[model samples]
Target: MPEKTTAENIFGSIVETLAESGSKQKSVSFFGEEKSNPVASQFNRLFGRQKPVYNLLGGGKSADVLLWRNKKVSASFLTGATAIWVLFEWLEYHCLTLVFFALVLGMLAQFIWSNASGLFSSGRSQTKVPRLVLPEEIFVNIAITISAEVNRALSFLQDVASGGNIKQLLVVLASLWAAAVLGSWFSFLTVLYVGIVAAHTLPVFYERYEDQVDSFVYKVLQQIQDNYRKLDDGVLSKIPKGKLKGKKFE
Candidate 1:
């Protein structure tokens, strides 16, 4: 009886040990998934962005168009822009000439329609053709929007020029320099079209590969910060500034 009890005790101990180890393994796996990538977590915290990319882009019609949610509308807009670019750039068509030709064709069609309708009618009365007149509100709204955007841009430039933040000043200067370099390389219209194409494509691709992009961007930012720190420690720290002193009165 004593030997049998000893064997039962050993079996029970083995079962408890195995159960504990299994639970520990499960817990370790759960926690591992929860803390998979510390860098991604740090990136999210640094940016303070808890929303998804779609919401970051305002999550409306504009975002939908950019992300290609409505494929028909998005494709139509892209095709129209491509057509216009091709017409002007490849075909060498002048904007004013195109507008003149379009207007002449529209006027001729309307005139023919009006005259034919009167000729077909039994009565000898002339039919009045409807004129195409744009609304005053459309022009007024466009002007107001343009003025507001211009004022906003001017305010931003003034603020940047006021020189409170050295970092901001450097960034603005770098951006302007980059823009100048790009202007030297390509015409304004080409640059604008490229920007439009980027806007149409980049957002969707970023959304699709968000995790990889975030990881890459985090590494890039970390490397930039390290380089800046090295620059500051090596060069900036060595620079000496002259002390300003008040003149003594006689």
Candidate 2:
């Protein structure tokens, strides 16, 4: 090989220095190894990071574009949904199936309209293809999270094998089984939506007519208490009580 010249020596030294610096630098990742205590840092110590709520993406291409329309749309959707739910409940109607059917019918109608006219205001809907919403990394991350959940579930089974509370374990298993069976048919989402509706309306209604609601509740409670007292005297009184004189953990 030919002798290394002065310029070649300088270039080689610069490359070596860059490689050393790059190796020592911390990697920039979506998630870091550092455990963030969100409850303590962000929430408990509000303004700890001193971040501005507005203009977070200040230096981006979409800088100064607040997208207030998105926020307004969300607020409108929530308000409209709540009003509809209240009206439907008052009318004694189940709207879950209706909502699902309406969505399907609406999409089909739009597709037919697009095919016939091909003049959608947003774009030519008939010509446009459905785009992927998430990045490839997002799908990989979701799969990893699901695998972690499955691992934890399997770990619970391992604990059950290692002489865990059989009664408690069995009860939990039974509850999960029943939930899965019901969820398969009626759907957990439908249950959650109904629960939300009940929460929004029932408490307000009860508080508005507190006296009447409480009187009805009290009568039902009185009947329950009488039955409970009878059962306690007949059955529970005959059951042997556990000793509480131990100093050690159960």
Candidate 3:
């Protein structure tokens, strides 16, 4: 019971961490406020609200090198394994048509959700739902769903990590689902694999860029401070100390 509780806590922490990471990504748009630097402003204008994860892929062959270095091979191997598992299980289910139909339905649902969420517009809209509510509510719901799934995935990983009664069969089943729904080839699985691999690799790239941003902002602040200091010492020093026409000097 104690072990189980400990495991649950760890799992919860992982979920919270993933959610926080995702939320941080979501906040890139907010960082583009009027007072923010020009680069951030430009970035916000260019990407609008949704910032792509690959934006972290700093640049060039180095990024590619990092991806391959981190998780490309493992993700590919898992994908291939998942594909085989999916094929074997698909023979049992024989529900390709139903799956495709469901996929279309899901796509339609997503389209509706996206539209209703006002992700397509600014805060104001003449729709049934409140304009202010749309983006925040939808994003909140999405975040909850994502956090739940991530929690489940993290639990699975934790079990494997701790050498607990790891369910190979369940893993195989999940792999099959991944391959079937997401696809084994250039599909969801491929994209997911790329994303995970990129996530592991691209932070280094992003950190460097982040450091540059920090330095730039520091320089800007430093210049502003110097200007303020100069103005205080020179111009402000020359101001008359006596009472003015309409007001007494404090």
Candidate 4:
């Protein structure tokens, strides 16, 4: 047999190891829904959907601009939306009294502001700010990915390695371990690992969302996971059966 150099042998081993280990994580689901254009979905998901009410983008009636121009009327809509989301969260946390208080106070503020500032406005030709256009689906997907990784790490450490810690201790330590492991994994892989796999099966998850919009991140993740599961199963089975060899370095 031809003598293989140390560098070649090491690179070959690394490639083989990666190819083998890759399959185990191939099937894991990251996020809840599928996305077509993640950045747009993220924007809509975060800032709430843009309405035809005000032309925030040029050639439009600037609701926020109008609010700035005539603080009273604009404040009502702005405050109302803010309060609604805030109140929703408060209610979710079971803070009924606080929600009631917020409602009462929010109503009073809107009432006072509406009377004080007359609702009159015009569109301004101000330049728009440049921003990273990550979609809601992508944002959600990333969050889900991070959460799943952390959860997996903790579960692996706690359940698989029983007697490692008490319940309270497990809760504390698991959170910490999960964060560290997740951070490390993200730092190492970036999106290339998942992105590559997602490319193969795009059509499988290409369902439309509300309206005519499609989600990108969700679909990508779905495909990636689909491919990953297949990869993981294939690699895992071949692990022990595969042959290994050594070479000396000069």
* TM-score, one value per model: 0.71, 0.29, 0.19, 0.19
Whole-model lDDT, model 1 = 0.76
Ranked by lDDT, top first: 1, 3, 2, 4
Q: Write candidate 2's Cα lDDT for 49-77 as tens digits.
A: 24432334343323222322245553455
* Model 2 misplacement above 4 A: 1-134, 188-233, 236-250
Q: What TM-score does prediction 3 earn?
A: 0.19
Q: For candidate 1, which ten residues in a row score worst on lDDT?
A: 27-36
lDDT of every predicted structure (CA atoms): 0.76, 0.54, 0.56, 0.48
Error of 2 at 155 (Å): 2.0
Instruction: Return the top candidate by TM-score.
Output: 1
Better of 2 and 3 by TM-score: 2
Say which candidate scores most in lDDT.
1
Query: Which runs in model 1 stand beyond 4 Å of their true positions?
Result: 1-48, 122-128, 227-250
Model 4, 60-173: lDDT tens per residue? 334333324455645565566446545444444345777788889977876656554443323444333334355899889999989999999778767745765577666777
How close is each model in CA RMSD to the real structure? 17.0, 28.7, 28.8, 21.0
Cα deviation of 214 in candidate 2 (Å)? 19
TM-score of 1: 0.71
